[model samples]
Target: MDWQYENGRIYSTDENGELMCEATFIRKENGEMDIDHTYVNPVLRGQGVAAQMMEVVAEYFRKEQLKTTATCSYANIWLKRHEKLYPDILSEDTSDQAVACKIDGKH
Candidate 1:
């Protein structure tokens, strides 16, 4: 899938030019970014589409040497699952217990 970066979000569209999925981030001071939103079209759920988008976004952060944090539920959950794989790009705030609980589907 092709990804487009605009207005603080990375998104993809379907053949019909419809939005397929997107991940949004807010830039913070000190070279940090908060990934505050992630959405996947219903038909694409459970197909790892969102994960793929986040991976690309994560890579972008790594390339720009930016720190990533998560506030949106999807972003938080994704971070908890993959944070270990991206220690360099992820924010240290992920150590919070709340993120862990969210990863366990408690929130």
Candidate 2:
């Protein structure tokens, strides 16, 4: 699989040019990216590809000194599960409309 970032999305495509996985987000004016969608081709699921894709996006945020918020359920779960790894890049719970994701204290 090959990963590519364009416009405001991160995605991977298969050798035949089929999209295998993707994570999409909205760039908020507050410098926080709101992840709105995350998906992996059924063939690409269960292999941590989604997580890896998100990691790349998170790393970008880290380098750019940005933050991230998740409106997608899958993304929210992943970020909250790996809180410590992204504390600096993950946006804090500020908006009342944001989901209250829980941390498992594993990281």
The lDDT values for all models are 0.78, 0.76
For candidate 1, what is the lDDT?
0.78
Off by over 4 Å in 2: 94-107
Best by lDDT: 1
Q: Give the local distance difference test score of model 2.
A: 0.76
| TM-score versus the correct structure, for each prediction | 0.82, 0.82
TM accuracy, model 1:
0.82
Local accuracy of candidate 2 as per-residue lDDT tens digits, 1-107: 56798877888887788889887777888767877777788997899888888898888778878788887777887788888898987777523225532233111
Q: After the best TM-score superposition of candidate 1, give how far the Cα of residue 86 lies from its true spot, in angstroms.
A: 0.5
Residue 19 error for model 1, in Å? Answer: 0.4
Worst 10 residues of 1 by lDDT: 97-106
**24-92: candidate 1 lDDT, tens digit per residue:** 777878667877777788999999898899899888888888888887767777777887788898777
Write out the backbone clash pairs for model 1. Answer: none
